[model samples]
Each structure stands twice: as C-alpha cells, then as structure tokens.
Target chain A: MSILIDEKTRLLVQGITGGEGSFHTQRCIEYGTKVVAGMTPGKGGAQVFGVPVFNTVESAVRETGANASIIFVPPSGAADSIMEAADAGIPLVVCITEGIPVMDMISVHSFLKGKPVRLIGPNCPGLISPGKCKVGIMAGEIHKQGNVGVVSRSGTLTYETVAQLTGLGIGQSTCVGIGGDPLLGTNFVDVLKLFQEDEETKAIVLIGEIGGTMEQDAAQFIKDKVNKLVISFIAGASAPPGRRMGHAGAIISGNTGKAQDKIEALSAAGAIIAPNPAEIGKTVKKSLKY
Target chain B: MKIHEYQAKALLSQYGIPVPSGDVAGTPAEAKKIAAGLQGKVAVKAQVYAGGRGKAGGIKLAANADEAEKSASGIIGARLVTHQTSARGAPVSHVLVEKVVEVRRELYLSIVIDNARKMPVMIASEAGGMDIEEVTLTSPEKILKAYIDPSAGWQDFEGRKLAYGMNLSAQQVKPAVKLMANLYKLFHEKDCSLAEINPLVITGDDSIMALDAKLNFDDSALFRHEDIRRLHDPAQDDPFEARANEMGIKNYIKLSGNIGCMVNGAGLAMAVLDLINYCGGNAANFLDIGTVNNTSAVISAFKVFTADPDVKAILVNIFGGMARADTIARGIIEAYQQIDIKVPVVVRLAGTNVAEGKRLLAESGINYIEAADFLDAARKAVDASKGGRN
Candidate 1:
C-alpha cells in the first residue's frame, strides 16, 4: 500500500470557491479522490462541482469526516489556513500556495512541532497516490499506478521523472513534492522513512536540486537504515554558486548545497545517481534489475 | 536580492548593530575624502552583488587617503571576475571605504532558515574571515548552530550555549549574546532570507564590530519593505532579468547557451533547461511565466527570450495543471502574432483541457512542433536547434 494517502483517505478543500481551488478540486474528484467537503470562509452554504462547502474546516471535518485538507489559499492567507486546518485536527494539510513569506512559514513550522498533523507545503505541488487519490496541482493524466516511490523538491522535475517512469511502463506508489522553500515541512529523510516502510514501494526515486544539506542528511539516512533499491537525481550540476536557480530553496551558498557535493554524498551512500533528469527513471529501472 | 556590504552594514547600523564607520563612494574623490577623515588604515571594498571580491582584487587595504583614492580608481569602473561572479564580470558601481579596526578575535555569525530543522537557525563559528564550509567539512564542531523558535524571542540560554561552544571569552560572551539577539531581530524585522556577518570581529579594546555583512531579502516579502526596495542595483543584474522582475515574472537567469526556455513554474523551467542540456543542447536562459494566466506576461516572456541574440530555438512548456492549458496556448499564439521571433518555436501543453490548447496551436499555422510527453517535447525542441538532430 502507498503511504500518507489511498482510496480510504477522505479529503477536504480549503479555499475551494477560488478559481484554482474549484478547478483542481473538480479534477481531483474526477480522478477518484474522496473529496468530502469544501471550505470557503464566506461561501459556506455553496457547493462546488456537487461537493458541499462549509464556512470553517472544523464544520467540514465534523460533518463529512474529511480527515485531510488541501489548501488553495493565496500566499498571504496560506499560514492562517494551515493553522486553521491544524487546529481543526485534520490529520494532513497540503498547501499548494506558493510565495508565502518566510517569516510566516517560520511560525507555521514551529506551531507544527510535536503536533499530530503532518504539513506538506506552502510553496510546493502536493503529493499524490497514483490512481487512488490526488492532491495539489500536478497533472493527474501523467501519473500511473506502479511500485516506484518518488519524492522531490521540484514540482516540474517530479513531473518529468514521473512521465519518464510512466513511459518506461513503471508506475509510482506515491509522488511527493516537499516544496522548494528554504523551510520545508518535511525533509528527504522523513519521506524516505515512509517510502522504505511501504512494501509496494520496492524501489524509490529522489529528485533533488542544488541548495541545502537535505540531500546529505538523506544520504546519511539511507546509509544507515534504508534497505530499498534507491536511485536519485540532483539537479543544478553546473549551476553557479550564490545564484538562486528558480526556487527560493535552490540557492548555492558557501559549499553546503552544491550539486557535486550532493552527488558525491548520495553515491557514497550506495544510491545510484542520475546526472540528468531524463535518465532518472532509467537509472532507477537499472538499479532494480541488479 | 543580495545586497552589498555597505548596504547591509548600513541596515545593521540602523537597527543599532555595531558596525565600523564607513561611507559609500561612487567616485575616487569621494573615497579620498572619506579615507582622509577615517583614522589609520581603511578598507576599500567593491560594491558589487558577488562575493569573494577580496580574492578578485576588488577589495584592497589602503594605508593612506592617497592610496585609498588609487584603490578606488582601480576598482570603481573595473570589472571583478570572481568565482562567484559571471565570466563577463561584475562591473564595480561603488566602493565602500571603512575604518579598519585592530582585531583581537574573529568569529563567524549568521541567521538563516534551516530547511531540515524548519526554523530560523543561527550559526556561530570561532573560525571566521575564511569560508565557513571549509570549517564545516573539516571540523564541523567549530560551527555551533542554535535553532530559534519564532514564537519565543531569541533565547539567551541558547546564545550563551553557542557562545560557550564557540569558546568565547567572558568579556566577549555578553556582546556575542546581544549580537545574536539583535541579529534575530534584524532577520525577522527586515524579512531577510539570510543575514550573515562574516568575521564579526572583537576590537583590541573589546568592542564587537560587524566587519563585513551580507543580507538577502525575501523577494516574496518585498511589498512590505519599501526601504529595501530602494537599494536594488539594476546595473548589477542582467537587463532582461530586471525587466522580468518588473513585469512580475519570476524565473529569469542568464545562461551561456543557445536554446531559450519560457515555461510555467520554477521546477518545470529548470527541468526543461536540464533536459536541453541532456539532449546536447545548451539553454541560453531560464524564464518562468510564474502563475499568471494573462496574455501580457506570456507576450513579455516571449519578447525577452527572442531579444537574446544567442537564442536559436525557443521551448514553451506549460503543464497547466491548475491554470488553463488552452489559455497558455492562446497566449503563445497571440505572442507569436504580435512579436517578431526568428527562432523555431517548440510547444508542449498538458493537463486541464490540453486538447483545446493543441487546437489553438493547430489554428496558428506557425509551423510549431507539438509533443505529448516531456521527453518528446524536449527532444523535439532540441532537434529544432542547429546540429541537434542526433
């Protein structure tokens, strides 16, 4: 079985009346996700694509038994939405909003400490369990039900890796975009632990970019505890130092978060390294063969 | 988003943080006047966005006012090519002339968002002036990190622990604690992503001074700080990048290649660039249209990409998961009609009424290549480039 989400997971949509929120909520419903309720602060009595809308997350959770919340709020309201979901006792919160202030995330992250709820992203594409449940803004048509588990910091890079895997006739158990912010709710090691425990996930593919020591920490985790066949690809191989490549988290500062250093660390930890994004799935397939 | 040392120090001084007396000089004459007023030795630092200026001969120690003037003349208009700066070199806009203090001890201090810990972290090290990475790789124990809770104020005990771990003297511990507290204040108040004081030196008479400071403001929070917005130096940035920022388009970095990529989302833009490189084609630039569904942003992106002489082929990849795929397609077609683009255009559209998007592209009759998957799109885009048939 996949981790975090499956067919049994009932979901709620926060900010569901917004254009993006309504559109993606409809897509998720069409993709067979159990979207029990939608929450828009003032539009409580309304319905979006036949899904019941409520004013507050607590009401939606209480009435529909929606255990998870997917937030489509804008950057300014993202932190409050996350906290509202957390306070409502939703088991998981997936925030698809990008460009939330770092200070806002600082408070959100600290508030999440020792809490039972798992927070996914403030600037990331949400996670998906292929063919079962979909959350966030990733294209549902590109994913397939398979055994390979994918985790990445980059949303489009995750899409590329998944598309390649689907092309190779390999499906993913779950694909998680942990977001590209400097302060992510979850780390590579946290996701690796879930992937390692999933029996359906025979092999895992990690797509990382330059910046941060998350890869190094993940490499160390794999070196000690992980037993699954893992293949990884770290982007920004030739990226210049100190320049932030697209994502706020993808900055190369000092010597801590270079691609070469990440590649070396992952390689030394017995993980196959795909130097290019195009070869990520192929490298994972090759690793599984051996 | 990287502010120069003079700007950072000026901000720090405004927040009551102790920094050496300094003035920014755009001309050699101004530098000489400032150097004359300062006692003893003065440090002339190049006011560019890049780091490692000292190694590039952009930073020089002047013994006298005449020497400072000479150093300023040498660095003011000269380009400094450091490992951090581009090969084209970063043009020196101004020079910061500051009083040189006699250092009794040097320490490294910074407050940055720690991803793994998911908090604002403070890093302190006894070894300063040199790179902190060298110290981390060789002897990680030299670096002491304190993860601060945003809800609670900067814990004095945490600062004391870090101060003791860094082997600070009794006289230095109080100021170090105060510095860490003030640094956290600056980090939160300024909405900074990173606030670093490399070589936070202790003077001979036991006063702590921020010798060099570097601050990177969070671009997302720029709307809140108008003062920080005024310090932006467009000359230190690429013209196209500055224009992209002004238009509210996010991703724009100048690369030395031939294929120009205009895509939606940061990750997709990077993946497209990576795919271009993998296919033996170089990407000239990275341009993300962000989340805008407007036609003007699309037209602006196309205009910027086509303006580059090195761009031989343009790749437009939009997944349109939340955004309407057909809207992007319409924008692309509208841009092609409005702008004069000489390069071959490769379009890839997916998600949320992709058929409609493809239909819009078909109606354009622009002789564009369409692909179903990312690989096909990347391959087709690369193939359209000169000598990329293989």
Candidate 2:
C-alpha cells in the first residue's frame, strides 16, 4: 500500500562494518526492515547483526537478491558506493551519508540520468514506510500505518511533524526525508508524484525550508498534477539573506528561495499552509475533513 | 571554503586564463616591493572574502611605490565592511598588488552549479561589472547561460556561442572561447561550487584578462583535493565560525541575536531561529550539533554558543530520530559539567527515548526549564532572554 517500499523490500547495507553503517543497520533490522546483505571492502566475511557482509555491492546483490540499498559509507567513498550500487542494478539506493561534495553529486546526478535507479539522499535521513519496511534511520516508534504521506528537507522537523500527526491519531503510509543538501537524488516534485499515485496516500505533508527553487517548482507540480489533500510548511522565515543556515541548501541568495516566496507560491497553488510545525497536525486534519 | 581574490586569480592563471601580474603581501613594505617590481602603476586591493570591496574603499589606485605602501597600510590594518559582509566586516590580512590595466570593456563571467537542472552552468553577460543577479532581474536578455553536461563534456562550440552571445569582437572571440573552456576545466577539476571572474575585461590592448576572481570550493569534495583545502584562510572567517570549523562542527554561524539555539538538523535549526523570532526574540547564533549527537560534540556546541556574549538565553530543541533525545540530554549534562553557563536555559525534547531524555535533564540539576511543545519552548526561551525567571 506504500509508495516506494513495503514488506517485499529487501535492503542491502553499504559500508556495513563501519560505525554508522553497523549501528543503524541493527536499528533498521529491529524495526523489521529486511536487511539481507551488507557490503564492506576488506570485511567480506564479517557478519553484522546476523546479516552477511560482502566485499562489493555487485556480489552482495547477486548473492542476496537485495533490491534496495541504504548507504552508510563515509563522505569520501559515498559517490563510488552509489555508482557501484547503480552498476550492480540496485533499483533503489538511499545514501544516508552527509557532507558529500556538491561536485561529486553533480557527477552522480549526471551518471544516474539514464539509469533505472532512484537515489533518495546523499545527506538525508532516508525513508520509512511505517510498519511495513524502513530503509533509513528514523525513530520507528513514532510511525503508524495509515494514509498520510510525508516528505521533508529536514530530519528533526520531519520527526516533529510525524509525531504531531501520530499524536492526533493520524498515521502515515510513508515518510521520506529528501535530505538538506543543495543537490538531492529525489526532490519534492519526485516524491509528490509518487504520493499522488499511491492509493494508500490520501493526504501528503511537505516540509520545505529556505533555499532552492524546488519548493516553488513543487508548488507548480501540485497545482498541475496532485489531486490529493496536501498540507505544507516552509521553515526559515527568520533566516537572514545570503547566510547559509546550517544546511548548504538552506541559503537565500538574491531574491530567490525566500520563505515568504515559497509560502506565497504554495498558498497561491491551493496547498494548505501550516503556520508552524506544531500546527501541521491540525491543518492536515482539517484538510482531510474538507 | 571561499578563497581570496589573489588565490582565485592564481587558480585561474594556472588554468591558462590570463590575469594581471600580482602578488600577495602581508605587510605594507612587502606590498610596496611587489608594486615596485611591477612594470606600471599598481592597484592595491584588500584581500577579504566579501564582495563590494571597491565601494568599501578596500581597492585603491597607487601612482607610485610610496602610494602603494600607503594604500596597503590603509587597507591591510583596517576592516573592510561592504553590503555583502556583516556590519563588523571582515578584517583585511593581506593586500594584492597588481599592475593596473588600461581601460577598455568590462564583462561578467561565472561558472556555478545550477540546482534545478543538476548541472554546472556557465553564465556570461555583456554587462559584467554590475551585480549579475540584478541584471538577471532587470535585463534578462543581457545574460546568457550554457548548461554543461559533465558526461557529454563541454564543447568548444558551446564556448564560442557564449563568447559570441556576450558580443565579444572577432579578435577577442578565440581567446574568450579558450578562457571559457579553461575556466570550465578548472571548475570541474577543482570541484568548485562557484568560480567567477567579474569584469572578465577586454583591455586597451585588446587582451582578455580576469580583473577580479572569486572561487568557492565544495567543502565535501575537499577530501580529494588536499591542495585546494590548503588555500583555506581562517583569517577571512569570523573567529567563532573559524573555531567551530576547526573543532569539526560544520554548521555554526554567529548571528546578532540574544537567544542561543542548538538544534539537530539544519532545517530545524533555522526553524528554531524563526520560531524564536516569532516569539519576539532574536537568535544569537545557528548551531546544528549534527547527526552524531555525542557528548563531546554537544560540549563543543555549548562552548560555541556560550562564547558569544550577546547570547542572553539558550534554547535546546532536539527532535530525535536517528539522533536520540537521551543522547542529546546526556551531552547537555556533560557540557554543563565542563563549562560555566550563566544564561537561562530552556529545552524541548521529543521523539525517541524522550521520556528518558527529559528525566535525565530533570536530574542534572542544571536548572533548565522544560516545555511541552515547540511553541511553548520558544516562548519560554524568548521570555528568558529578557531576564525573565524560568
């Protein structure tokens, strides 16, 4: 019933023997994600959380029939790991590693153009299809299986929004953190398209911050294509212009990518705007009621 | 990751793009020597990261070596505040002395990563000396863009088309095309986020030269380019920001506000600032503790915040998913143990192991006010910043 993932999703862990990879793999497995294989060069025979480790993604995929991969490789090797996964024919690759160079992403983005693969994030929290399968690192307890679909450019704010929805007895079909990097694999438009088509997703929540024209572009898509109820919130209303607010992508250059601009655009496109993060639950509830 | 104009020009020159003969000098005597060594009248340009240095009197013409020394002394020891920089301005540590070129035409050229297209784009305009963003708004036709596909590689024809579109004369066309290609190669080879030559000038002798250069490196890609990383000048950065970068804290920007904010993600960290302002308080700084919420990292985050004398109160908002609230709470306690924090503190913890996190904070005896939600926490922080009792 979920959009990108469900029970049939078989996961592969890249950089499985590393500190972040090994730790989050255990959490994902505990959350009931089918993590069948792990890949770490020079540690091929090792087992992390009972998952078999291989030296290469190609070997990991061939032996385990792993369809998806969540990469926890360090920033230096993340691009190579992603390309390896793509070369091995993994349909879905979620890069949880942060601090990847923009130039590296530019090359990766170019290489993935004609490929049959979808990359979620190079600096994102990854995606979770609640109660069915979790590919990346999100707190498992806060999610419940329902119809609401969430996509955000943030981590903790996404958690806050989902928690509010869960608190209001509203569960989600899938929640995706598209990452806070300037260049991302899957943007707001891509996720909105999926949410629009997924039968389980009757409502969608989009959390955007200052930076990029993605939110404006997403507003256009929502106006043209999306037929479902959408509740949105744009952060960084107080951020100064020309200053990068934590995220590389969260800077407002010139008159573009301002919070007010995004807010007005989304509002003009008929998307319900949550005044703040705490108001998302009520806004979504109200939108679904109408 | 932004290099000085001198450093950027050196990089451009290395790629076969012509630049005025210049050398960087840390002292006025050195600057005078560099100017004396040049063939003609020298221009003493203050080496700072911010733009609009010309308007800020950071750039001055010196007719002689003595005048060059005076210009260098006036600029090197002074802070050059421009519209692009903060009010305090960036301190000038060096002066770039170069042979002044004969007047001709000024045109704008830059290479940047376009996010929407997910590609490197070269932008050129006939009107180069003015702000390109302003030109893009007012006169869109004056600007020309060429999207570069790394896989397909850049073609010389694309450069020729851009050079022609920029209205360069036939004699300037070949050199302009070659310079464009070299700039693209340098941009791609160095993994630069932004490489610009504002006033990519046509001199009186009909020669093409980069009048001003600016290069911003991709911080993430610096691992592969250790040589590029070596060009980093900590003197150009704010002291707190520089210190934070040295300590492995990537996301820390000092702002002129009273409430110190420490949040997990960048988006939420900014949201925290907005919420603080919404509740009628200014955030003193933006500090994202990052994904690995360990005790040492938290301690470092607290140190960066408390180091700011303007931070009247502290707001710690952690919505844990991969970063657990318990881990953050432990870090907060550990930070309080090591540092003396006098500001009123308010904390809001939610999501994973939040109950345990709140309990840990309650037991720490640090006298922190716990709020039920985001709005309440913000209100409390704002109130605390005004010297209100928690």
Top-lDDT candidate index:
2
Candidate 1 residue-wise lDDT, B19-116, digit = tens: 99979999999999999999679999999988888889998999999999999999999889998877888889799999988998899999988766
Alpha-carbon RMSD, candidate 2 = 1.7
* Cα lDDT of model 2 by residue, A125-148, tens digit: 899999999988888888988999
State interface RMSD in Å for all models: 2.2, 1.3
Stretches > 4 Å off in candidate 1: A167-169, A220-228, A264-276, A279-290, B39-41, B61-70, B139-141, B164-169, B323-325, B369-373, B376-384, B387-390
Candidate 1, position B205, lDDT: 89
Clashes of 2: 1
What does candidate 2's lDDT look like per residue over B16-110, in tens digits? 99999989999999999998999569999999989999989999999989999999999987899999988889999999999999859999999
> DockQ numbers for every candidate?
0.54, 0.76
Model 1 DockQ class: medium
Clash pairs, candidate 1, are A146-A171
- Which regions of candidate 2 deviate over 4 angstroms? none
